[model samples]
Target: MREVSDAMGRPWTETGRHWWVPAVRGACAILFGILAVVWPLITLLTLVVLFGAYAIVSGAMAVYGAFRGVHPRDSRTWLAVSGVLGIAAGLIAWIWPGITALALLVLIAAYAVVVGVAEIVAAFARRRAGDTEWSHLASGVLAVIFGVLLFAWPASGALALTWLIGLFAILYGASLLLLAHRMREAGRRGAAGTAAHAV
Candidate 1:
């Protein structure tokens, strides 16, 4: 672990053994974001269809897991409930493809709002923990703004969601790739360090 000083000159250990993962994910997210922004309408439609498919598949899997009783009894109950909800959602979407886009937009907007609020709350909590968390605050603010904008303009939100999704996906993928790279680097470093110690 490498120790670095914070703004307050407090030593902090950089335990980022898999830094490359995030970097790759971030890069992929960026690419996806660009695609989403470029073809918002198409992306929105595709996402709706994809969501429906995913819901059905996930619901089936959940139900299977519940029946399999892989975990505790309570876990199976939760899984069953989740499966039911997923199946219901999928059925609704499949039955009303015409309205699926609008419905998805509404759901996305609601999710954004909930996530935004949570992030803001988390940022505040982090700040109170005596850590430098300006980035978290900024991110939270952006999320809130995005959510508000989506709510304010439903039509625009639908289109924007696609771009947002793409961007997020690309970034996520890039982050994963970066983390993998970083892990490899860390492993190499550790091996070298061990070799030097042996010598």
Candidate 2:
């Protein structure tokens, strides 16, 4: 973990920038949301496939972001872990496309709980690292709450589950978008400050 954490990101890391990672995630989520809404008549099998793809893509993007940045310490490790869990969940759904809505909901709940906890821990870590420019805490809390709610009520019907999933994706996507904007703003400020000092 330490070695990986200390190692530099791939040569393409610089190209991602911090904001681009979350921006990609948010965009994917928004697209998924639009699809769900526009094609409400899609079959259950299609929904599962769409959701699996969304989870896998989201996880991949997260992993890329974690590894594609020059993060200090073990700060970004949780992000990577979250990404792994997401990928695992996605693969499970893909393999068992015939799974019931309740089962999918359970998987989603579990994923949310794990990822939410990671996000909260990462939030504190980022703050400790003097990167208190984002609102991850709120997002983390929301995720936890969403997970708990899903867990508490696993009997939700198929249509309801679909809507709930859609809502979560949209909200999560919006949050990431805001966080990315903050990251961009922070970079701009940092560059401006550096230029001022140079002048």
Candidate 3:
């Protein structure tokens, strides 16, 4: 919520704290959850196929990027590792398409657990730092619950992970889109207000 002064010495408030962004994100998340629940198998299969394609593309890109690096000595090791891991993942998925879905589910579950713990820790840190917003803490609690559920019954949770991941992606995308729209709107309103004040 920082305000910036224009060249004309007019102050413009930042619109980053607007509620519309979170609302839109939440709506998209709900929609994604619904879609996953409605078409679980299709979503799961599509995700596995998509991961394989991504891994191959990413591996090739990483290798190319590594070669094009200005400081080859400094970045070569990291890039090579990235390329190797990506290529290996792609090969594994290609060779065992059937196990890809299960593997993905396990990875997702592990990620959820790690992320949940991180969020919870962050919430506590923020609280200690005197941020009064309890919503962050609530979100952390929800994340932890989701992670536990994901790990508890992985076989049954595979479908659940699809729903959760889809929801998160949709929400994150919608948040970005909404924030961009809101910023544009705020700019227009600020311009109008300034013109009126000048008149």
RMSD per prediction, one decimal? 9.9, 4.9, 10.2
| Candidate 2 lDDT tens digits, 38-145 | 776767778778878888998898788677663434557998898888898889989998898778778878887887887788777766655553556666776788
Query: Can you write out model 1's per-residue Cα lDDT over 1-199, one digit (the tens) per residue?
Result: 2323323343222213334433432353355456566764575556666545545654565466456532223334544665566567667666777764556766645543544454456445434434343443453355456656666774754654676655544443443454345435545665666578799
Model 1 spans with C-alpha error above 4 angstroms: 1-29, 40-43, 49-99, 154-157, 160-199
Model 3, CA-based lDDT: 0.49
Error of 3 at 21 (Å): 7.3
Give a tens-digit lDDT track for model 3, residues 38-87: 66676556665654554455455545544543112333445455556656
Q: Which candidate leads in TM-score? A: 2
Model 2 TM-score, 2 decimals: 0.84
After TM-score superposition, what is the CA distance of residue 79 in candidate 3 from its true location, in Å? 23
Clashing residue pairs in candidate 3 are: none
Poorest stretch of ten by lDDT in candidate 1: 6-15
Candidate number with the higher lDDT (1 or 2): 2
Worst 10 residues of 3 by lDDT: 68-77
